[model samples]
Target: MNNPVMEQSTPRNVSRRGLITGTGSLLGSAALGGRALAATPRHGRAAAPGAAPRDASIADGAQVPALVIGSGYGGCVAALRLAEAGVDVQLVEMGMAWDTPGADGEIFANTTDPDQRSYWLRTRTKQPISNFLGFPIDRDIARYTGILDAEDFSGITVYQGRGVGGGSLVNGGMAVTPRRENFGAILPTVNSAEMYGTYYPRANTALGVAAIDPDWFETTECYQYARVGRRHAQRSGFPFVFVPDVYDWAYMKQEAAGAVPKSALAGEILYGNNHGKKSLQKTYLPRIRATGKVTVSPLHKVTTVRPASGGGYTVTLEQLDTGGATTATKEVTADRVFFAAGSVGTSKLLVALRASGALPRLNEEIGKGWGDNGNVMCGRANHLWDPTGSLQSSIPTAGIDNWAAGGAFAEVAPLPTGIETFASFYLSITRNPHRAEFSWNSGAGRVELNWQTAWKRESIDMAKSIFDKINAKEGTIYRTDLFGTYKIWGDHLTYHPLGGAVLGKATDNYGRLHGHPGLYVIDGALIPGNTSVNPFVTITALAERNIEKIIATDL
Candidate 1:
């Protein structure tokens, strides 16, 4: 999706052009008469124009034209498009604003030195790489609302971002569009031509997706690890490809030149990127605020949704404190509601709502077709001669593409330990066919996913197809100290959780709930698990297509 013209343009130029030309009809009408609002304050700190009010909160008996649950990619898209259509929207998020800096003068904590700003409501941090150098690296932390949520189930741990921007707040910013050939498998019901020709490019342009300068990447000290990874993959006869990211490339260049404060160069992913990365807070949320038809309330958790006595849906929400305590309960009515609380959150809510007699007409597919996006991690112990650098960039630039041949695309991830580990780390997304289901457990009164850890075996094998060959070619072995003692595969967790309330089965072609006229599922829950690569770009594009149709037809 990288245009040569866009690659050569600076971020400032790109932003200006995108606002004027890329959004086109989507923002053109709204930009003319929309009242600009302040951006959603980060952790209560005031932000610039194009943000929601700092004290924005839904009143107990509020009534809105549209209510969007969760402020992630899909929710943001739905909110923006609906607002552009001149509808008033109230967006409720379960996480903090993250606009204010902490005592350490940073809005987000570093990955290596985490504090209360790391894990969500956990007394101890749950690092994806739980150990390093044969020792557990997990540490105790205050129980506060943090960025990443390492939600543990019976067999696997799902790491999710908890905040207004959703997964965009804590991801590696690898904005990838699936191959056109593979799009059929990704979303079989959708028209690939429209997606590729219009929505994908639209999403890419609005997302500020850009490729790194190839010449600079080849020589930057920060990307030495990626270069080494490329060498190993190419030497082993695997295809190495550069992936586009939402990060500000010009700012990254300045970071490399020591002209600005380092973010990607400093160990700053996993938790969140303080600078450079163009998360939803910088992209979609600002646009939503610019529409001036939306009010976003952070730290508000939706608990129940039922048909109102008069009409529409009556939604119950619990306002939460930083320590995960509910301080107030409120009710609001909306003519229409969009479920955009991610895959797991959306599925869990829908399942519970269906089973709890709130929305009994929901189909049986409410809790079905859930799958981890074939996420698996591993590290290779390189020879001492090829020591991975200590000063590594947190942003991943390249991946070993074995998807067509081996059903896996391995991101040459960074250790970013700030020390020479002589290890090459990777996060592989593979074609694992196993799909799990989320069911409501009445006795436990919670949503449960029957995702066994054994399901990851296919993913591990697929990833090994690339790494094993590289290891054989380079005379190396799998690193055993990263995940746990003697463990070679980090298969117990997934960063990309998809499906559950799938597109065709759970909703109509445009995300309208099958039984409910005004309810929709627009988040990752619509996808059936795998996307053949990173899933965010596809998610955004799909939401874009779905909302456009809904605005034209429904609204």
Candidate 2:
């Protein structure tokens, strides 16, 4: 455990020296267990060797037991676990380090003067909305080709994060352990005692997840919002549950020190919590790095992975910055690698690699069975209610778990993005279609997601039922008809996307691509089907479970 003094003294700033070495394993392997060892700082920086005159432009091979791609939830979890197990693990993140590159690592913050504009985008565009969301992709189309039109962009709910922490760095930070049943659904093969009792606790603690502060529950915007629904449920009681969140209690304490009086409560979390929120970058990865065996290399984009001569993997990478000049291309070798670059990232990379004949032995299920978990936005009303000026700081502190009763499950959370307060409920109900297809378009360099519409009536019927109940109640001045009014009958925008590379009776439950032994797929791509709820926690827990199995077999 890290002492408070050490935690406090650790600088939040990013060091340009790039990689730091320390002595401690990720997994709890006794083989390398010892006092944490810190490597002496190398004062002079070395320009990437690939940039110089080299026959083949690849980074000199540095051997490690495990190499994790993408520092998102799954990759971070895998890196931490393997490092603790005495494995020499290296983590490569495509995104740049946070804070310096501004929000999404797209621009620099200090480039614009304080008198003019603090960020580059503010000066570059006429409207804030247009510059931020409107620009389509010219360069780096793989990640940033604005898919949504102006009107649809406003209506279209999309989420993407690029930084040391990945999506967890900029998400709403609401953390809820999946209902034990939902957690069990994916792990039909794994036993309950091991799955729920052990790994669940480990993940929760690692995440520093907790129920919303009881005081906040009473005073926060959530209470006022919940009151609208409670009045309706009073007539015919339907239990609503308060879900847990990943908001950082300590960061909240620190912000309280400066005391800024804003209408919002917990700093508009959806647009990136500038104050205090429990993002993965701020939470787990730091702790994982403290173990010393793991080194995180940011601004590193992995393009290809090939089976090496010694029965390991040789990963081809590109250094985004070397002496202010980007390198040609670099490669590194690792005994094992975990691909946890979220659903879209993993699927695209795998599909492209297979198309390139880099890893042809990858399972036939490379890009198949992709579903977005039928998402709907519905709201309730309380008579005589006027919450116009009330602070809608916290995002999604309350929810109804009634979708399970109607073949699907719906989880509702507050949407406080200054978009619309009337939308008291942003609900996503699960839709289990028999099959869906995923295909990658190389010309466009994007993955196309298509889902067969089944259980359509059930989906609308469920949304209408929830909406009607809320409106019927008194003292509520608003109504929700996101489905009927919005014409979002087809595919609704969802924050949670699952199933591009799916798990099944065919592939290993742990997501080791069917025929490929050492290559693994441990992100959202492995969910057997729609999780019927937010699948981030499920993804993290499943990764933890999978890493445990990997250790049992490999270590």
Candidate 3:
């Protein structure tokens, strides 16, 4: 455990280079044994290299009628809709189904005590932001099929999830719809009337969204930090609005009352939530599987894609085992391919495919219009009069809306350490017009993001506009203990990465890639960044609208 004296002594303004390292722990906890889940079956055994494909059914490489490249919100929507319309679909995911139980029978490793199961195919943990202080909190662990992925680009580190549920698995459960008035600018091609009236409600209902009981929120000890944030923001002449989340508020109440073992209470998020949070693994994917027409291929990465000689597309995949070793290579022919592989995933693939000439005429706009969703994270050291609770819930339930003047929507985030640190954290979503481009770097054999460290200054300025006011009103200093001592701003990482293949430009208004009839880009890649809130709801609603169009016209 980190000593209070050491935490206080840790300088708040460490260099970015000095912040990241594989040093010893500042805080530590032993892995708690999780509740055992039933032993669900895996799809198939992995094959050895140069051997037949793992699944005997697809060993001969049959023609797949409809294919979805990810199992996230967009992909699941595509899969379920297509299946309901009687189009046989195969959904490909690059991570585990997360159904298998661990040795201790837990489905996931707790963030506080991560082991091999804390990351996706990495030797050590790579958190989105490096430290709660100058001290190192990330641990060295074996490679395994973990949930969170902190994918590094040159100028930024993108935080995504590596499981059936994708970002839903690792994200805070806040589900926000973009303000109706602000929706037109981000996606001018999209019909706002339809989005607000038809799709957004449809999506929220399907996503199992519910508000925290306000009466309960006011009294709950778990949410005392949120109340503190609300009070602070209100005191600073900001309206603290209640943000809805996908977590079961009633269950959270149970967790708070010691009726259940601590999961969120124990500070377990940004890895995988063992309880409360409703990831796709719990909701959408299960319903898709119930349709009986969807087959998921996990641990398979599509490395190459090309047009088939006759028609449709041919995709080559490298299958992997739990240890990240290649098991076999195979190909599949698909009549239709839906790119639901989140913004970064789909953009990287598309950029590489275009540069490699596999998708020569994809579009001039294919790799354009990517944004970080204007993410800025910072912490304020509150005075003793305003003590943020030691026991905190990882699920954020409130935010400050300074978007009218400051152009920022800041969430009162959680530290969730079960320890009092006298800090108030805020993650601000700002309005940054600086979008990055992804270009294939043949030398590196990867698609490099054109974003630079300098690009974040715009985002920082927008977020600081709001925070500076709050800090001035409250007379509290920014916390140097979180994200590095005195490194108050976490400007290099983004959990909400949006756009690459934008809505109207990269593809048509309905997300169909311009030149390719059956190829579509449907995820966050379709939204040209800045959803004006947490993005999953907009991503879901837009996907709903697009799939409706394709099913009615294109199919």
Candidate 2 wrongly placed segments (more than 4 Å): 1-61, 101-158, 220-222, 233-236, 249-266, 321-327, 379-389, 407-412, 415-423, 442-446, 452-458, 473-491
Quote each prediction's TM-score. Answer: 0.92, 0.73, 0.90
- Top-scoring candidate (TM-score): 1
Write down the TM-score for model 3: 0.90
Cα deviation at 183, candidate 3, in Å, is 0.5
Please give, for residues 1-555, the per-residue lDDT of candidate 2 as tens digits: 011111111123212110010001011011111223222112123322111111112244777678888878888888888888888777777655544222322221111111111111122211111111112111111112111111112223334555556677545566666666665665566666776787767877877777767675565443565545444544434457777667755445334444642212533443344445666755676667677777777657788888888888888887664222345577788888788877767877887888777888876788776555556544432222434223344545556556566444445444333322333444646555534545667797755555434434456555545444443433232231223221323234556656778866325877788766788887877875567666667678878888888888967
lDDT of 2 at 538: 69
lDDT of 1: 0.85
Shift in Å, residue 489, candidate 3: 0.5
Taking all chains together, the TM-score of candidate 1 against the true structure is 0.92
Candidate 3, pairs of clashing residues: 12-485, 12-486, 13-485, 13-486, 132-481, 480-485, 480-486
| Candidate 2: count of backbone clashes, pairs at least 3 residues apart or interchain | 17
Model 1 Cα RMSD, 1 decimal = 12.0
RMSD of 3: 6.2
Report the error of model 2 at residue 554, Å: 0.7
Model 1 regions lying over 4 Å from their true place? 1-44, 48-52
